[model samples]
Target chain A: MLFKNLFHHFGRYVIMLGSAFSKPERASMYYKETMRQMNDIGIGSLFIVCLIAIFIGAVTAVQFSYQLDGTLVPVYYIGYVVRDMTIIELAPTFTCLVLAGKVGSNIAAEIGGMRQKEHIDAMEIMGVNTAAYLIMPKVIAALIVIPMLVAVGAFISIIGGYLASVPTGVMADADYIKGLRSFFDPFNVTMMFIKALVFSFILTTVPAYQGYHVRGGSIELGQASTNAVVFSDILILVADYLLAVVLTS
Target chain B: MIRTEDIFKSFDETEVLKGITTEFYKGKTNLIIGRSGAGKTVLLKLLVGLLEPTSGKVWYDDTDFFALDRKQMRNIRMEVGMLFQASALFDSMTVEENIRFPLDMFSTLTLKEKRQQVDKCLERVNLEGANANFPSEISGGMQKRVGIARAIVLDPKYLFCDEPNSGLDPKTSIVIDELIRDITIEKNITTIINTHDMNSVMEIGDNIVLLYQGKLAWRGTNEDVLESDNATLQDFIFASPFLQRLRDAALKRG
Candidate 1:
């Protein structure tokens, strides 16, 4: 029974996405909607993303500094560890997991409310190809903007490490700067972007599926929103693991 | 005109509509009236392609709606407009913006032309100069009017209104009914209204279909209602003792 239910949902989700990728009845309307979504997702969440990144970087640096205090590893290695840890793992994963809760729930609620209010029906009867008009713009915007946010997050996290260690006397400024500039592999940055893009697709589309197929009243809508966040978080972790193994191998 | 052929809809083993076949005519206000669970809304949804019939066919003029490809289906939809019960205007958009959304999505009109069309629609719905107000900021009657404006904005050939007067005052209900009827005649469009409001029935019901227990029980115009001998129709139309007595008196006089 569970497998049947899963297959049903999976099939419906794939079909919904298939319909969402069709040709737009009008190009300019889609472009305008995409721009609006970009502004909302990118600029709207920038501050919170930056704030969380700084805290993550600081904690990682502080804990690593403690761990390395009596070890063979040099103090400058704290900078390298923070930098690599951030770009390779923390930036894309942490940022997207947070976004899965913040933006994912909002998307689910917005679309689900539209469903209940019959806006989707109205659009459909207008020949608008509602799946394309509603879902495509949001997906496109997330694909474009999420990677940029992750890049910004990675940069901010490194600064956070500096602020936590250097000015606080945990480490010397020269050693930290040397650590940051030392042993930088550009491939790690490429890996970060690939993770960002994959995670972006998951976070946006999962919530959209939940919202688009939502049935019943407000309570059902709330459950869909909650499910969007929970499912998105779980899938992001799974995807992170899979991408790590696949990309590394 | 639209025609249904042996339409049936089932939801998880519960048959909501059973072999319902009917015809709604052009340039007339066609009403589908029934009790709450008699499948009025379901039938309307089936007609508009929002819900597919379990095993039946719907015809739009000479075309079979279900047999069409995606592009052809969209071509049919382009000529259709629907007014939902709650009006379904986008909350974030102003009244004018809501009406202009369809135009913006499908029409090739320039910005000025689109604005002009929006204004014309708003004027027709008697909502001129109320362009910037959000749906939440307006009364329910005005919201319904705005919904009507949006529906007619594209000059659709087929308009579907579901319970267009559910929560309005008698005066507003009559106004809405007249507006819908006037638009139907003016545009020579096929207008299907799913409603149980007796005032709407007597006022503008050029064609009426009554469903009882998923089966179409009766169909006639407002003129036929006074003299019809169908017990189901008579029972539905004159549920109250007062109305029944009134109908009896009218029949005796006739």
Candidate 2:
């Protein structure tokens, strides 16, 4: 039944896509929605993503250092620890977890409210494609904003790890920087970007699709919002595992 | 100006519009009247192409609405207006923005021209001074007026209103009904309104289509409706004891 509904909805969007190419106003609305979503979803949540990154980086650095043997796993390699941990896993996947919590629920709740209020129907009646007008802008904005958030988070996490290593007498600043410079891999950085891009798509489109399909009243809208976040979060985790295994293997 | 042929729409096994066929003429207030779940709203949606009929065709003049391409259909839709049940004003937009939306979509008017059109619509709906106010800042009646302004902003040839007076008080409902009727006649626009209010049916039902159980049970003018002897429509009409008493008294006088 869900698949059937999905097909029906997809066909509706195909019509929207065809119409969008010919209609400048539709395209303008898409840009407007993108700008609105970028402000609403991305900028508003930046502080929280940054805070989480800094704290998590500091804690992970402290924990990794405690387990290291001074002779073999030298304290100078703490910079390598921060870089690898951030670029490999923490930045792309976990930051999305945060966005899935904040942004995913918000998109769902908003679209659900519009649906309940019959705005979508009104749009249809007025020759507006609701998905093209409402959903695509958010998708484009999310695609742009999420990668930026990942980059910011990665930078902040490294700074946090540097702060954690500051009081440690064993790790010299010069040695840490040297380690960071020496171990840097273009492949690792590339992989991190690929992961961030994929994560952004999953974090954005899935929640939006769920939110777009929401129906009935306020109770159902609340349920749809919760469902969008939970399902997107789970998908993000599952996607992370698959991408990690596939990329690293 | 609008005609439905054997329209059949259902959700799962439950029929919402069961092979209903009807005609709505131009230059008048054509009201669709029924109780809740009488397929009044469903029929309105179908008429406006918000939902495709399961097994029927809707014609706007000579063009089969379902057979038209997106561009052509959109061209047709541009000439049409709808006032939704919930008002459906954009929460993020001010009254002026909402009124300007349709014009912005379909017109090549410059920004100043758009503003002029917006101001004109706002004035028509008696909402001239509330241009900057958000939907949340307005009362239900004001919101409905804004919805009306937005709907008619493009000077549409056709107007579809679903429960225009649904949440308003009796006096407000009359005001809204009168406004719709006045606008319909003034512009000579083909207007179809979905309503359950008997007061509306009596006040401005130039042409009224009565539905029962998703079927077109009766269709006639407002005067013909009170005089209609069709049992189902009569039951629907006289369901209110006050109306029933009025009908009985009229019958006695005759």
Candidate that would win on lDDT: 1
Q: What would the per-residue lDDT of candidate 2 be over residues B1-254, giving only the tens digit for each residue?
A: 99999999989889899888888889989999988999998889888887888899999988899999866787788889899878999898999988888777667889899999898888888887898999999999999999999899888899999999998999999989998998999999999999988888988998899999888889998899866779988899889889778878988999
What digit string (tens of lDDT, one per residue) describes model 2 on residues A67-114?
A: 785557666677788888898899888899889878888888877788
Q: Tell me the whole-model lDDT of each prediction, alpha carbons only.
A: 0.94, 0.84
Reference contacts reproduced by model 2: 0.68
**How high a TM-score does candidate 1 get?**
0.98
C-alpha DockQ of every model: 0.88, 0.65
| Quality class of the docking in candidate 2, CAPRI style | medium
- Candidate 1 wrong stretches, greater than 4 Å: B248-254
Error of 1 at A59 (Å): 0.2
lDDT of 1 by residue, A100-180 (tens): 998999999999999999999999899888888899999999999999999999999999999999999988999999999
| TM-score per candidate, chains pooled | 0.98, 0.93
lDDT of 1 at A44: 94
| C-alpha root-mean-square deviation, each candidate | 1.2, 2.6
Error of 1 at B137 (Å): 1.3
